[model samples]
Target: MSTAEDREELLADVGDRIRAERHARGWTQAQLGTRCGLSAKVVAHVENGQTSLPLYYLAELCCGLGVTMSALLSDAWVMPTRQREERALTPRQAHILRVAASTGLPLSQVAARVGTTRQVVAARLSESYRLLGVSHLPQDERRAAAARIAEERGLFDAIESYAA
Candidate 1:
C-alpha cells in the first residue's frame, strides 16, 4: 500500500499532467469544467491538488481530454508550470482540455468517449470560451492561439522529449 505522502505525491503528479494538458490547449479551469459537467470551483480544486480525483470521473476525464488513461497516470507525464503559486488538476479538466485540443477527433466521437451527447460537448466548448476575459474567435483561430501558447510555454516539446 502507498503511504499518505506517496498518495499525495501521486495526486500531485496527476495534477501536474492535467495542468500541463490544460496549458497545452490554453484553457482556463472554467473551460475544462464546462466540458466535464463540473463546476469551476471543483475544477480549481482538482488543479490545485486540494482534492483527489475520484475514480468515478476518471474515464469521463480521459475521454474529455482526448488522452489515454495510461498517459495521465504515468510518471513520465510531467508538465511543470512556471507559476510562482503552484497548482494541480482534476482528471475531468485535464480530459476535457486534452480531448478538445489534442485529439482532432470529431465532436460526436469526443462525446462518445465521454458517454455524453454531442450537444453537451458543444455547449461546454462554447461556454468555456465565453467565460474568458478576452473576446472569442472562431475555432481555427482559437486553436492557433492555443498552439502558440503551447509553443511559447514549451509544453509540447517537453511532452515529446519525455515520450522519446
Candidate 2:
C-alpha cells in the first residue's frame, strides 16, 4: 500500500509529465482542451496537479496528444511501497510494448501471439504506460519522449530501447 503523500507525489508527477508532453507538441492548454473536449480550466487543473481526471478523460488526453496512453505515463507512474523504488513492467507487458515499439505488427497479431484480444492488449498497454508514466505517442515520438525522460533521470541505458 502507498501512503497518501506517496499518491499525491505520483499524481503531481503525472501532472507534470502531461504538461511537458503538451508543451513538447507546442500546444496551449486551450488547444489541448479543445482537442480533448475539455475546457481550458480543466486542462489547467490537470496540468497543475490541482485535480486528477478520470481514466476515460486521461485516455482522451492521450488521443488528443497523439501519443499512446502508455507513452504519456512514463516510468514514474508507480513507486513500490516496500522498496520505495520504481516499478518494473511485467515481462508480458514489456514484451507487448517492445514488440509494438519495435515492429509495426497490428495489435490483433500481437494479441494472437500474446493470447489476448486486441482490445485487451491495448488496454493492458495503456495501463502499463500509466504504471510506467510513459506517453502514448506514435512509435517515433514515443521513443523520443521516452529517451528524453530517461536521459533526464540518468536511465537512458536502462530504459528499454524502442525500435526506430
Candidate 3:
C-alpha cells in the first residue's frame, strides 16, 4: 500500500476502536463529544475515518472514553482483566484516581474539579493505593505507583463506562 493507503487503514482502525469503546459505554456520539468538548459532527467524522484528528483531540477522546492512547491506537493491544482477588475501587475512588493520575494536578486542584475537599481527595487516593496494593510504597511514590498499577490493570480503561 502507498503511504496514503497506509494512513487511511490506520485511521479506519482507530475509528473502529473508538466506536467500539463508545458503544461499550452506551454513549451516543453527542454524549462522547460533550464529554470531550467536541461536536457530534466531529465525533461522526472521526468514527467514519473521514478526517484526521489532531493529537489534542485524540487525547481528549481518550480521556472521554477512559482509555489509554495506546489502547485506542494499537491493533494488538488487549484490555487487561482485573484479577478476582483484587479489591475493586468504588466509583468515586476510581474517578478520583483517574483524575489524579492523568492530570498531574495538585490534590487541591483535583479536589476542586471533583467538588470535594483536598483532604477527601487525599483520603480517596490513599484508599485507591491500598486497593491497588501500592500503599506499601513510600508516601511520595504511592500515587505514581498506584496509577501505574491501575493503568496496567486497565482500571482506567473503560472505567467511565463501568462506573455508569
For model 3 the TM-score comes to: 0.47
lDDT per residue for candidate 2 within 1-164, as digits (tens), equals 56977777777777777787787666789999999998889888887777866887788777887777676676644322222236556555665665565565778987887677999878767765665566656654663354344345543333345312
- For candidate 1, the clash count comes to 11
**Greater-lDDT candidate between 2 and 3:** 3
- Please give the distance, in angstroms, between residue 3's alpha carbon in candidate 3 and its true position after superposition: 0.3
- Would you list the clashing residue pairs of candidate 3? none
- Backbone clashes for every candidate come to 11, 19, 0
TM-score (C-alpha) between model 2 and the true structure:
0.44
Report how far residue 35 has shifted in candidate 2, in Å. 0.7
Model 1 alpha-carbon miss at residue 8, Å = 1.0
lDDT of each: 0.61, 0.68, 0.84
Candidate 1, 104-133: lDDT as tens digits: 677799788766788877765554334331
TM-scores of all predicted structures: 0.45, 0.44, 0.47
CA shift of 140, model 3, Å: 60
* Of candidates 2 and 1, the better by TM-score: 1
For candidate 2, what is the lDDT? 0.68
